[model samples]
Target: MEVWDRALTKRVDPIRYDAETGLKIYREDQLNLGKGGNTPLCPFDCDCCF
Candidate 1:
């Protein structure tokens, strides 16, 4: 249905985004997928990406 759907269905890629250039890319990696493993918890004072 969507690119994400295709990626997930295939399940062999890493999704990447570069905020500076607004570029998005995807590739395959068996060890990692989806939001990465551990991310720093959202900080209350941060206005970034909220």
Candidate 2:
């Protein structure tokens, strides 16, 4: 086991860790959802087009 994992296994220690936040974070688990399209939307209703 890795040094980090060994440290985490130390029972009776006050730490917050669960299955959802597992010891390892695989690349697949990380969701990279950026702006779907390059087109950007205006923040407010402007008459720039009109």
Candidate 3:
């Protein structure tokens, strides 16, 4: 699965997962959202607009 890394302003592929826990491993910095600011608005064409 692919997820956007908000801090890095780019996308990244998961490097590996813990087989027993099924947890994905990612860089800590890549997941942090600095200052916890306002949530980003959905794209104009997103289904939520309809």
Candidate 4:
């Protein structure tokens, strides 16, 4: 959480996922990707976003 907050400098609302990466959450736009892992990674450089 600290890493993400430092990188993004904004609060995040993450959707958890179970995968080889462990805790995974794909950041996305509601219109473009529809959220979740199905959505592409976020444009931000935040660790959690990736």
CA RMSD of each candidate after superposition: 11.8, 17.6, 7.1, 8.9
Best by TM-score: 3
lDDT agreement with native, every candidate: 0.42, 0.30, 0.55, 0.44
Measured on C-alpha atoms, candidate 2 has an lDDT of: 0.30
lDDT of 1 at 50: 21
Candidate 4, position 24, lDDT: 52
Comparison by lDDT, 1 against 2, better one? 1
TM-score per candidate: 0.24, 0.13, 0.40, 0.26
For model 1, residues 3-50, the per-residue Cα lDDT tens digits are 333334553333667889756555533333443434455343432222
Expressed as tens digits, the lDDT of each residue in 1-50 for candidate 3 is 66675545577766789899998887655444243434354343332211
Q: List the residue pairs that clash in candidate 3.
A: none
Question: Could you arrange the candidates by lDDT from highest to lowest?
Answer: 3, 4, 1, 2
* Top lDDT model: 3
Clashing pairs in 4: none
Candidate 1 minimal-lDDT segment of 10 residues: 41-50
> Which stretches of model 3 miss by more than 4 angstroms?
7-9, 33-50
Off by over 4 Å in 4: 1-9, 30-50
Selected candidate, larger TM-score, 2 vs 3: 3
Say which prediction, candidate 2 or candidate 3, comes out ahead on lDDT: 3
